[model samples]
Target chain A: MDIIEILFTASFWAAAIRIATPLILATMGELICERAGVLNLGIEGIMVVGAFAGWMAVYSGTGLWAGVAVAFIVGMAFGLLHSTLTVPFGLSQHVVGLGVTLLATSATYYAYRLALPEVTSPPKIAAFQPYEIPILSDIPFIGEALFSQTPFTYFAFLLVLAVAVVLYRTPLGLAVRAVGENPSAVAAQGLSVTAIRMGAVIVGSGFMAMGGAFLTMSAFDSFFFEMVNGRGWICIALVVFGSWRPGKALLGAILFAAFDALQIRVQQTEIGAEIPYQIFLMMPYILSILALVVMSRRAEVPAALMVPFNKGER
Target chain B: MNLRKNKRVTMRLEPIENPTMLRRLGLPAAVLAATFLVASLLAMIAGANPFSVFGLIIKGAFGSKFAVLETLNRATPLIFTGLAVAVAFRAKFWNIGAEAQLYAGALVTVVLGTGLLPWPAFAILPALFVCAILAGAIVLLVPALLKTRFGVDEVVTTLLFNFIFLLFISMLLEGPLKDPMGMGWPKSARLIPEARLPRIVDGLRLHWGFALALISAGLVWIIQTRSTLGYEMRAVGLNKEAAAFAGIPVNRVLVKTALLSGGLAALAGFSEVAGLKGSLTLDLSPGFGYTGIIVAMLALLNPLGVVVAALFVAGIFVGADSMSRAADVPTYLADIMLASALLMMVLAIMLTRFRVVRG
Candidate 1:
């Protein structure tokens, strides 16, 4: 099929939305963390732990929602460890974040081996199936593309809106934003900057794990190694692309997913047949670098991002 | 007057003007004990006796002459990558793309060593080494330039480059670099015997790469302690604004640091292929670049310490692999131990300069 013909198909849009589901969730998660002034480089490994935890829970006969909860809680446990070191000890965020990633990933792998020692291939669980909304499903083109998705996709979209509201409309959001921009100002206001930053990291990390859980529970049926495959890092770039805004970050996720879907389809076409498939696989990372270069020039980074705040220190 | 006031005691970290020798030594010992405790807990969860597991690991690492040599072989690449990370981190450049640079070096090695060079072994070997360094240097230069000119964050860009470079290498392996006579495998053609690194001793599996690594570590130590560029890098890392004020070209120093770091990491790939593997494959590195961060951190970013650190890290992996076969626990326990060690070491380093005081 030609490029234009592919773009017109509802399947393409449906695939793009499906692809964007995890990115949307994870980007929102990262946006929250960055907005709160902590760069969670642990996103990648936390996502791995999430994928394994959620899938393992479901595989063990827990309900789907319970699996998600399991993933979120486990992710939060790691986040607590992360925040404890970064916030209270005021360790180098870069080193501590990477250490957390290493810890989470290795711990997950060890757990997976202990849980399923005999199986060569990962066993599949009955994952979340697509749910068609009553009226929205009947719309001509848009309905099939957006409404007819797994409950996970719907939750991801709703999260963007909810995050946007909380970030701009609520007092808690203001405090969170204040902590990232000017922690001393927030501290002067009799608010605890440490509490806000730690809380933001913990909650934000839960969302990131849910994004990972979406892959095994919604996108695919089984947990596997390297399945998250740099999506977490892409979400980091998306936060930059969105300038740490929820709505814009959601859009960035979808746009990136669309390109991803397009590349997968393009590989099957005649023009794609002549090029090495690895070239097609490389588009997402290359595009992320381009996007980072384009947006970083004007991106308004959090003023206190990566800067540890020691209260009462001159 | 304050004595009559309510004295609320709360713990807070206070800067220490000078740490006593015992405090410096005790903190690190405590950190090691903490890491060991965590590892023991993990072993218990895996249904293995923690003491036996620890015993197996130590025996497996240093039991036989063969085991010691195996660790030295594994440590060769780590030493290079660890030095690479230590140097860049010392400059505060955050060069996390050492994995990609290592592959870049290997790619160059295969391209030139696979009958592409018709000269004598002496000329061809040096040429291949120089080209590998150049390739790795160029790969990292892109991100460094982006950071310097476009105000981009090197962390994300460098991380992204790892994925991109891997795909690029995959393309080459499947297309042009594909071994023609070998069975279907995504690997490059083997290097000529002339291009290979000589074994350190006859009948010994160890190669000259280990010697090169030791020499490299000594050279790096000298550079870090005795060179002007090393002084500039330390100044930049300590305080960028102050370094710039002191007439150091901060951006230029960062770019130069990237080249040196990338080149050092590339040597790992070169050594792996030239000294042992002789052919390039996708799994040439099992996350050596990422593991280098652990090594660098554990060493406190000290150049000579990186050598000792790399050896220690390699022993764990070599030991863990064997221990897994003899025990019920998974081999990834090594990774968990090292990661915890990294975190604990960083915290301990901080405690050496700052004391938590109750007020």
Candidate 2:
């Protein structure tokens, strides 16, 4: 099929939304962390831990929602370790973040081996299935593309709206924003900058874990190595592409996912037969760099980002 | 001003005027103990006796001549990558694309060594080495330039480049550089015997790459301690604003750092393909670029210390691989140990300069 013809198909849009589900969740997670002035480079490994934890929980006789809760809690536990080092001790975020990633990934792999020693193939669990809304499912092509998705996708969409409202419309959001931009100002206002930053990281990391859980529980049934596959890093780029805004970040995720879906379909066409398939795989990373370059100038980074705040110190 | 409102007593860090030698030595020792403690806990969780696991690891690492040589072989690539990270991090340039640069080096090695250079061994070897360095250097130069000119963050760009370059390599292996005579595997053509690096000793599996790594480490130490560029890099790392005020070209120094770091990491790829495998494959250096960060940090980013750190890190990996066969625990315990050691070492380094006081 031609490019325009593929774009017009409902299946293409449905695939695009499916691909964007994880990115949207993870981008919002990263947005919350960066907006709080802590760069969580541990997103990649935390996502791995999340994928494994959620799947393992479901396989071990828990409901799917309970498995997601397990993933979120486990992710938050790691976040606590991260924040304690970075916030209270005021360590280098870069080193600590990388260390956390290494720690989380290795720990996850170790646990996976211990849990399923005799099995070569990763066992699958009963995953979340697509749920069609009552009235929306009866509508035209747009309904099938958007509304007929797993409950996880609907939750992801609602999350973006919730995050947007909390960030701009709530007092807690103002305090979170102020802590990232000017911690000393927050300190002068009788607020504990440490508490806000730590809280933001912990809660944000939970969301990131949920994104990973979506892959295992919604996108695919089984957990495997390399499945998260740089989605967390892509979400980091999305945050930059959105300039750290929730609504814009959600759009960026969908746009990126569209390109991803397009590439997968393009590989099936006659033109794809002539080119090496690896070229198609390389597009997302290349586009992320391009997006960073295009938006870097206008992007308004948090003023205190990566700068540790020590009370009563210059 | 809000001290009256919040009456809770909290601990704070105060810089110590002069830390005693014992405090400096004792704290890191304690941190090491803590890392081992965590490792033991993990082993226990895996249903293995912690003491036996530790014993097996030590015996596996240094038990026989073969085991020692195996460690030395592993350390060769790590030394190069560790030095790459040390140099760049010392200049405060986050060159996380060492993995990409390493592949670029290997790609060049295969392209030139697979009968493409119809010259004598002596003439071709040096040409291949120089070209590999240049290829790796050019790969990293793009991100460095982007950071300087466009205000782009190098961390994300460099990390993203790793994925991009790996795919690019995959494309080459499947298309232009495919080994036609071999079975249907995605691998490149092998280097001719003349292009291969010579073994350091007769009947020994060890190659000259280990010697090259040692010499490279010594050279880096000299550059870090005796050269003007090293001084400039340290100054830039310590404080960029002060260095710029002191007439140091901050951006130029960062670009130069990218070149040196990328070239060093590329040597790992060159050594692996030329000195060991004689052919390029996808899994050439399993996360050596990322592991280099651990090696560099554990060494406190010192050049000579990186060599020792690489040896230590390589020993854990070699030992753990052997231990896994004899024990129920997984081989990933080594990674967990190194990561925890890195975190603890950084924290210990900070504690050496400061003391905690509860107020």
Candidate 3:
């Protein structure tokens, strides 16, 4: 088949949206956290922890929703740890973030090995099956692409709207944006800056964990060491590419996912098979950098981002 | 007015003018002990006795001459990378791309060393060092240039570059550099005998690379403490605006520090290739670049302290590997221990910087 014929298909579009779901979910969480003036470098580790915890829950015969709940809890715990260190203790954000990642990633590996020692192949569990919306499924190309996804994908899109509303409409959301722009101003207004930041991080991390849980429970049946495969980092980049907005971040995620879907499909085709596949894999990362360079020119980042706020000190 | 000003001067946490020797040493020691205690809990969770696990680690890392040699061998690359990170961090350049720089260096070394040129034996080592360092520096040039010209966040750019270089390596390995006789496994051709570094000990994998690592650390220390470049870099790190106002070329110093960081990390790749693992494989560095960040942090960004810190981390990893083989303890426990230790140390640093006072 011609490359154009292969690219123009409902299945390809469906795959693109499905692939973008996790990025969309994770980027929203990161956007909220960054909006609160803290960068959670621990997202990568938190995702891994969530993926493992959720996988274990499902493996132990718990329902998929239960697995997702477990992931949310684990993600919150790690986020709490990150906030306690970076926000209250006034430690270097980058250092603590890296430490958390190393610790969480390694701890997950150790625990996985301990749980399933000497297994020849990875243990498996039944994954979340796709459920189609009744009337929406009957529509043309857009129907299959948008409506026939796992429940998690549906929740991810809904979350984009929910986050946008929460960030723009509510008193708590105003406090979060104010804290990111000027924490001292928020503090002067009698709101506890630390509390608001901690809340944003915890809530954001829950979404991140949901993304991880979705990966283990929806994308695949079993957990592997490489399952996350830098999606967390990609989410970080997408946040910047999206200019810290929910709708833009969702669009950016979908774009990158389209590229991802395209690459995988091209790799399997005769015309593209002669070229090494690594070139295709490199495209998304390179494009992220270029996009950042362009988008960053007009990007309005939080003023206090990455700076530790000590209430008593200047 | 004077009475009101005096009343406003309430007791609070204040920065120490000069910390006592006991306070300086006691804090890190206490943090270390606490980290180990937490790590023991992890061991217990894994169904292993913590004490025996610690004993096994110590025995495996430092019990005999062979173990000690192995520890030093493991530490050799860490020291180079640690110093590389320390130098850049000292200059406030967040060069998270050392991992990529190391790969670039190793790839360049393999490309130049594998019968590419017929240089004299005495000239090959020096040629390799210069070429590798230059290649590593070149790898970081784009990021440095972008940061200097456009104020790009080096952390994101450097990190993205790492993935690019990794894919580049995979492409090279699977295609042009694929070994003909390896039965389909992707790797570069083995280095010539002259390209291989000589052993430093009687019967150990330890090589002259260890000496090179120590020497590099010492030179970095001197450069950071006793040289004009070091002074400029530190000035830039401390306050770029003030440094620029003082006629110090801020961008120049930052770019130079970045190149230096890349060069030093590339030398780490050279050490690995010349000392152990004579051929270039994708696995030549098992996240040594990332570990170097931990090492540099644990050392408080002191150039000379990186040598000691790198050796200590090397011992932990080497010990953990052997412990896993000798006992039922999983090797990942080492990662947990290292991470906790680093976090604890950061906390201690904060504590040492400020003291709580009664009102």
Candidate 4:
């Protein structure tokens, strides 16, 4: 195996990065909400909402970028709905998440058709066009693979720093973390736990919406039934694997992308021809569980990840 | 929503409000009334008479001998998946991987149906069923292991496997397992006759798998009620710390439930291969596993209730399809109907669980 040959292929890393972005966005979204003490198991449905909303926007003459904004709105709406069910209604997070998934599924399959009967075709607009950096193009393989990408590519990286600042430096961030750790203690100070969490959820879902927007307006630019697939759930797993850190989550996404890329490569070549294809395809999941087992000891899991805060409880 | 400190501490130790039978009956009636009214409105929109269309949907779904058979064929897989979900729900576990488990079961069915087993037909059917069950169980082992050992959330993990498992199946069918008999399509060889689940009431699609599913539901009911293990399991579900104090292995109970859930979902796959398709198709379950969650919840996780609830769901589902072909209404509407019903059911459940009174 010539390392040079593997490194030089544009198609290889492009597809890999494309495959990983949705997971990255979804997990990043999960990270923010998780840090705020609300472990949103609803990211899956949130992404689905984005996928449908994005596609519907495009199918009705709005461009792909318009779809991106629409998806953001849709994602926020899901966050709002989840907030009402969990925060106000006192529903179980797991049950609410499950219900949201079913709702999203129904919405994706039916709501779009109900809303847009005129669009005969499943929306297939222009995806986000890729661009190569001019100065960075001088350096060969690494620069091309790393820098030459879409606007969301840069946003995803920038979001890590932004979220890190908000999580650590800001007063709101401190309040949010304090709430997660001990809501009663925070409530004693008169800061609103409900408001901060609702804000976090909306912002978190915006990140997830970008992920879904990428799937529709960037990844393949067409909406299929169950198109978001299970990347949202995978993102939830990444939140755990990434140890609730945005930087570590980017690495996990890239690592997953690498595995997915390798699967495609194997499918195209004779090297892994002897291996049963099903076994090879499941490599990413197998590796994820294995990585989890090895990393769980070192991971700084949130002390109050999914423990629903009941302020009045003893 | 009502967070009262006085009620939180020791008030729960004493019984408060018990829901009356009229209120309990009212919830289901509301759902039925809403569904019929909504369906009738949709029928009018489609330019068909509401009453006549409603009749047709039911008649096409269950009116004639053949239509009734079709409903049974559709309902068989739902029974298995519905029961699988009911087990998890009773234990307060959310198992969303039934779709993936069903696929895993289907993958196993293909392996046994086509791969060299060196066995007779009668032996092959039993072997295929066992293999399918094993496949489904294996996928669930990860989530169970994660939950018990690492305290990772199983809901996300099991749900993610649904996507991963389906992709693996797609890769297999397209590459290594591509049918030798077909010209380029991603399918496998038809099952050997011995491996096929026998048909019941010939000339219709009803199969022996229906009998197996109903019997399995009975078995689940027995295990959940009559057995000592059931008592311990319910005790763990009711209060994990209390169960642990009483020396029940809480983790072991969860693991067992997870495995049983996976196995039952896989059995749904077994029926699909053995009775419906006669071979593994990519669309094995038609979201039966996902729909099973709604069914199990509607049934309140009672195993016996799952059968009746599953049949009702299956009826609506098949009826939706028939209505689509006959009345030009989209089948996707059924999904919307079910989701709305479940959303309403949750509120109804919460209301039924407790009563609020002004102090």
Candidate 5:
């Protein structure tokens, strides 16, 4: 009816939560990788492969859980490739990440065509449904948004807390952060920098893949070409916007998701009928760029980012 | 010279001051072989016959006159984009917005070609080309400025600008620039005959654009090796702090090279529009900008090597398309092969520069 009413509705918040889930998942994954000094541009392609893996598993008569498991494993494989190139081979991270993305996206498309063979309508799977927490569901406005969500959404929120705690509190977390800042110092302390980086990549990539699996499993039932729709790239921006903190990253995800939800809702209203919808789609990206420019001064980029560590070199 | 005899020193790995020609060539060859083996395994996993697919690719890319011409035609735009990428990467600018810059060029050309200018038939192509290059460069000016002035990361800024350009183009096509007589399709009006690039041959689709691509490559090589500007750019690329210490204007070098890079990438769109399509449309570039990065990297950002690398990369893509049609293998096999090849090439280059020592 009215703009304020539209923004405040329960349905709007639910939509925002739903839209934000994948972004949160991706941001969480990217935070770990960036924290460890790897910019995995392969997230886009990994997500596509993950989406495909989940879709194929379900299409091939497996359960939804099995599909998600397969997706996570597939994502980790790409992470391993990135690690091999960047960690041990000491190659350029930007080039390697882009190459991995191209490879994964192409491989996913090829596999989908070979296995499915039919292109009339895309194949679909029975997707994950929302599970409402019993008592939590009874609350008024925020209940539907926070309590009743796909299993993945709840897991995504829990992951934000988990990542924050692990990153700030644990020795392994300290090692990962230390390696990003000063790999030489970490090496002198008798820790395997490569091992820690490799672990961070694999774990980060698993979460990235889970984000994709969630898309196919919960966001929508079927896969399509470019369904990830630059969310992986958005996640890259979010990592910077969030200032590499899990709490801030989640807040950024929610902010983006809210705008996304608003766009979809506004597109259907009478007042929004006159405007071109592309403007709405462009909002999040434009906002992120502005935000990055403003926050870049204080943002703590890893000191050793994009630099390959040669153990003996200055 | 110590009174007590020192323990004999063991041999240690040292970085070579200059590698021989043979090592340079052999390392790349080995890397190619390793990547091929890996890609073959991937193809097998995808349920295709790897040997047959490889054979088909070679045959389809270069087995006949028709295939060779097609490969070159596909390679025309890549050469421009590759050079664009090589130029920026040589200066260490890393402009990833070539795709959008290409679109910007195409947009300028389309707007001008569709009755914006009254230039004579003989002058339209050159005018459009120049304008498009300027438009492409202008589109990147903001990012370059931000990068130099504010310490913003060019990679992110350029990428965000790409989405902006694409959306802007989509808006134009769907709103003001829609074709008036395509029976409701959202296409632009075809370019006038005078605006089209003349074909180089009677029967083949190859145009004068191929010559432009070659000349651009040669010019890039000359500029990179012989010119003062190129020297400054390279110096900046190697180390900004050192270049600044050496009295080079690092910011000027970065901004100017980025403009040139964007201009070169835009020329690709100009060639595609004038030579092949003769009009603007959605999906004009099949990720040529991204592929350009691969081509440049495969050549190690050497300008002359870019010519060979672009052709090689284009051949795989074109050949894979043919193979998919003829042998029923998907075109994505080529992508897997290309990715592995790039990975291996970069790995080989790095490995050749450093050797392990037994301490």
Candidate 6:
């Protein structure tokens, strides 16, 4: 195949879409949690936990959807754990979050080892099947490649829209946002501030878990130790870059994902050889830093973020 | 009859809710302790004695003269990274880029080690040290710029840089710095003999780097306790607005401390390459930056306490490796131990800072 031909292959874009899936969903998950005033630093660890939980359920014959379900359950459990420490325990928010990340990293990595100590080959499940959009698949140079993506990719797109709605149009969404901005005011208005934040983390983390589950069953088809990597942290930056809006965060994810997709595409073209692969790998990180620094002056973070609310003082 | 009796159940209640600090940690501490107990129990289930397994890890880390020295050797970088974290944490700055800064420092040392610049023995050593410090400072600039200029959260910026530096180092090793001696191994050329850190023992790998680590700790302590910059940084950490109103040059102080923190961390990275490996490799940090976070907390952000915390944590990590090899145990046991210790430290440290009320 010529360079163009090879670049246009269905599998290549599938891989690109695959790479974008976890980041897109996880970032959206963070977008919700942060907008509600809880910086769940455990997103990486939570993603890993979801990966392992999803894998375990599927590996035991529950099928792929069950794997995704378990991931959500796992996410909710962690959300509860983190909320208890920061919200009620009134511990240092950042430290607690960082601690959660470390704990999650070691727990999941070690657990995977013990559960599969004797297996030489990594466990696998039937990977997600690609579903091509009927008419869109016919577009030249883009359709078959972009439209024929795994079902999870499409789900990620829809969830972005869903989150945008829940965050703006609904009463529960307004309350969540209110709690993040000023919990004292929310509490005074007869809302359970902790409950709103907790609910957001629990629900948001469920999406993040699906991001992890998608990795095992849809994206890559197996669990690796620390599978989520640092995409969770990247999402934190994206939420800021997007100004804490769901629709905006998705755009940021795609933009970064586009940079990621472009890097992989350009690498295959021998033209990218002049610049080392490290530069390409570092592109996402570099972009994140640049985007945050360049556009952050007017950035709006949740006013009550990282602050503990005292029920009595309010 | 049974329903009627259940409706009259006794309502006895205990007056004390959380009798001890440990009780408050009942959930996590229990989860953590039970997890280890079960992990150790798994060792027993794996046909190894749990007690012996634990004993072997302790022995492997400190049983022999070489083992103890090696543990100290491994921990040298952690002291600096831990301080890097502590300084930032104290100043309320989240500089997770210590890992990247570590690589930046190592990269500079590699350039110097491979004769990228020419100077006398006396001049080359000092110049390389300064270069390593500067390399670290440059990498930290991204986060500082984002935080100060754009109001971007430094946590994410610094974190993203960690991966960037790692990838940058990988590219260098695979391209400009590839070893040409034998095979396709990805490491830079070995350092010149003169530039190598002097070893302390005849047979052991322990070197003057350990002393350098001690001196670094002392310098950090003096600055934090004695100097005005340290006072300003600490003040900013407590409350940025208040410090700024008091006429503390907040931005300048933050930038300077960030550079110092990065530079210090870079020294640790440089030492590891120069003193231990004599070259650069991809596995430069096995999460020293992450571990430094735990060290900072364990030390309560006290610079002097950082040394003790570093050694203790290093002992656990190395001990785990040793225990794993000798007892046929998984090295992950050590991670479990460290996690438990961190949880313990968090609970203990928080007690001194704030009071947990029943209301």
* Clash count list over all predictions: 0, 0, 0, 0, 0, 0
lDDT of 5 at A88: 57
What C-alpha lDDT values do all the predictions have?
Answer: 0.91, 0.91, 0.86, 0.76, 0.85, 0.78
Best by DockQ: 2
Candidate 2 ranges beyond 4 A from true positions: B1-9
TM-score of each: 0.98, 0.98, 0.96, 0.87, 0.95, 0.90
Off by over 4 Å in 4: A1-18, A63-65, A112-123, A131-143, A265-280, B1-16, B31-56, B107-110, B113-131, B171-179, B355-359
lDDT of 4 at A129: 73
User: Is model 5 an incorrect, acceptable, medium or high docking prediction?
Assistant: acceptable
**Which residue pairs in candidate 1 collide?**
none
Cα lDDT tens digits for candidate 4, B112-221? 78746898666888888888888888888878888899876677667767767887887778777778886777787787777788877666567899998999999999
The segments of candidate 5 whose C-alpha lies over 4 angstroms from its true place after superposition are B1-14, B46-48
For A1-314, candidate 5 gives per-residue lDDT tens digits of 77778788988989999999988988888889888888888888888998889888888999888888888889999899998788856677888888888888988988888887768778778998999999998899888878899887898999999999999998888988987889888877866667778788888888898899888889999998889977888898888889889999999999889888888888888978888877877887787778778878889899977776765566
Give one digit per residue, the lDDT tens place, for model 3 in A1-314. Answer: 66688667999999999999888888998999999998987788888888899989989989988889899888888888888788766677777877887877888898888888898778888988999999998899988898999998998999999999989998878988998999888767756676788888888887887788788889888888968877887788899889888999999999999989988998888967999989998988888888878877788888999877775587
Candidate 2 accuracy as TM-score:
0.98
- Encode model 3's per-residue lDDT on B1-359: one tens digit a residue: 02121234333446787888888999999988997898789888878898999998999899998899999999999998899889998888987788999998899889988888788887888899899999889888889988888666777788788888999999999999998977899899998888888998666768998999999998999999999999999999888899999999999998899889999999999989877888889899998988898899899999889999999999999999999997777788888888888888988887787775643
Give the per-residue Cα lDDT of candidate 2 at B295.
90
Q: Which residue pairs clash within candidate 6?
A: none
Predicted candidate 4 versus true structure: per-residue lDDT over A212-296, tens digit per residue: 7788777777877667766777777677788888788888888888778877687656666666677666777766666666667
Clashing pairs in 4: none
Stretches of candidate 3 exceeding 4 Å from the true structure: B1-13, B356-359
Tell me the lDDT of candidate 4.
0.76
Share of native C-alpha contacts between chains A and B (below 8 angstroms) recovered by candidate 5: 0.51
Model 5 residue B187 CA deviation (Å) reads 1.2
- TM-score for the first chain in candidate 4 comes to 0.90
